[model samples]
Target chain A: MTDTLIVPTFDEPATEAAGRKLVIICSKGNLDMAYPGLILGAAALGEGIETHLFFTFWGLDMITTSRMENLKFTMLGNTAMHLTQAPKMPIPALMGSIPGMTGVATKMMRKQIADLEIPTVPEMLEQITQMGGHLWACRMSFDMMKLNEADLYEEVEAVISASDFMEISEGAQIIFI
Target chain B: MPTTMIAGRPIDVNDEGFLSSYDQWDEKLGAELAKLIGIDMTEAHWAPIRFLRSDYPARGETATLRRASTVGGFAIKDLFELFPGKPAKKMAYIAGLPKPKGCV
Candidate 1:
């Protein structure tokens, strides 16, 4: 019997008006952790993707106006923290526990980021929003933190429930951190 | 390193059709490239193109969206409307410059 082969071809380029959606769930408020979701969301927006960031728990600190600019950088419990000038040396985790260590770490980290001309967290949030990325605060965490709508960056859309987040993000690739 | 007839002249373009030779690009070619990508050219469109063309020699790299704003004075949101889906890549493509390397 003669057989016919059928092949399906998809000719669309991913960056060409494809309605790709990405939902990044941010649960960490640490200075370093904040960048991943924000940076990724920005990249996705630049690629014409619909990007949303849900800030919950400590992550709420990222969108909170009072704390966003002052997010802490602590090497506590992180054995990988080492000075760039001394990359071979390991920083003792206990060293992060020292009082004022986070301040030193934050200052150094900020300087490094500034050296690369990276924007501050607040500036990044503004940039992402201007690029059409959506930012949502977890309602429960928002209430638990005693945060009102006014406490959030003005660009934040709204505080939404987990179910609502899921509903809005259906068919989107979700990343939790 | 492939050559194709575009804008009524032989032009150098990469495999994805981004112009590879900077000197071969002019206003006419930029508009032609933009049309192929479904972009209707406007004066707003030409600003970033000119910026990228002039900025490339000094920087030696395509400007990211952020650089387009901070350095070139074109706001990010406005650039989005100008180039639509992918501003950095689209602007670079229409300008006959290399694609931007920075994420933002």
Candidate 2:
């Protein structure tokens, strides 16, 4: 008896369409944590996927009108920052705790992202929204921070509850950043 | 190399059922495509599809969901409701355009 080999082609239209929904949850507020959500969201939108970003907890600061442009990067407790920025001669961890070091690090990092032509957090938020990605602020965070809708950037579609987000994110590939 | 008959006309489509040529697209063809996907064409569905068809010829790219929502005057949620999951791909496919670049 001859054995007939049957190979199945896995690249099907249904599978391709099924993987198209992406929901990104941004739970961290710092400069380092912020970019992954925005960058991935932007990339997803560029690829014609239905993308939504849900900002909660500290991440809520990213969509606020005042805080969006002024996100900070603290070197203290961030060993990765010290290693990457000054690889040959790493700064002492104690120096990172010095006052004004965070401000300096934030400035330098901002310059690096700018020099690389990467959009700032504010610009990335704008571009993502303009390109058809949805930006939603968490209502719990908004209320906890005593921030009104007016406090968020106009690009934010709504200040939504977890239930609302769940409704929209149903059947989506959820990513937490 | 596959062909689907729409409104008594033969239209070429790819193996996965996307139209092979944008030239063969018409309102009737779009409606037929929507039907194949189990969607009945409504004004809401037509809005983005029409926008994509016209917008693509000028821009040479697929409109992002946000662009479609803004330019087509529909809310982003409305788009999700209209196209369900994978609205961007569904809209591009029904619009008789190539699978939008960057789309997985």
Candidate 3:
């Protein structure tokens, strides 16, 4: 499992063709945080690269059937998030804490994503799984959240431990998002 | 872009071997390109390839998997089996279209 092919360039020759592998550690559940891992994993799979997404910590919410579609985008503690009209000014953390602010932020983000015709979270999971990307739920997170297999997205492969992830991630490029 | 024979005549393709000129694509050349990538070019394979060919003109870019499934009416699961390892790139390559630009 430790043996993996050297990364191939864009113009990979047929004889030396060895499929690459990628593992993404999805550790956050925010709507903004969810996209980075899903996007990268799907991009890798599109290129014929083997891709695995491991959802741990709050990231387990990304795969939770009830939570995935409801992920919120709160600007609190996100220093980089700002309104388009005032890009120079970072929205105050206190402003992000106002009641119903998470809903507004999430709605705005969804509209922007939709304008570009991007798929929603559920759609992304479906497409990724269909394209042969592996989805895994961390056992520790699953237990912490008191979640069951039925509560998670159907595409999730299994609830596994950290050591199990290391085993499968051998020789694969790892991305923590 | 480099000029090279696909089916028989010369067509422009990029460094990664995607067809640069969208109009140069036809079924014969599509079959030939599929052969280069180890695909046998069945009707199932043609579904997505044909979709990409028709889709690229207005979109000006290759269609992503979701678009292929949604707009082209092709199932994502079937696409995986038909094109194997790299459906999006493989489909676009055979369709004589540029690489897909959509992240989703």
DockQ of each: 0.29, 0.05, 0.36
Query: If ranked by TM-score, best first, what sequence of candidates would result?
Result: 1, 3, 2
Show pairs that collide, candidate 1.
none
Interface RMSD of each: 10.6, 10.3, 11.3
lDDT of 2 by residue, B1-104 (tens): 66766667777777666777879999887887777676899987888898898888887777766567546676665666787655677787789886666311
**Where does candidate 2 stray beyond 4 Å?**
A1-19, A83-86, B1-104
Summarize candidate 3's per-residue lDDT along A59-150 as a digit string, tens digits: 99999999999998888888888788888976678988999998999999999988999889998888888888899999998998889899
* Candidate 1: tens digits of C-alpha lDDT, residues A19-78: 568999999999999988988988888888889999999999999999999998998877
Which wins on DockQ, candidate 1 or candidate 2?
Answer: 1
Worst ten in a row by lDDT for model 3 chain A: A1-10
Question: Which has the better TM-score: candidate 1, or candidate 3?
Answer: 1
Model 3 Cα interface RMS deviation (Å) = 11.3
Candidate 1 docks with a DockQ of 0.29
Model 2: per-residue Cα lDDT over A56-81, one tens digit each: 99999899888988899888787655
Identify the candidate with maximal lDDT.
1
When summed lDDT is taken over every stretch of 10 residues in candidate 1 chain A, the lowest stretch is A1-10
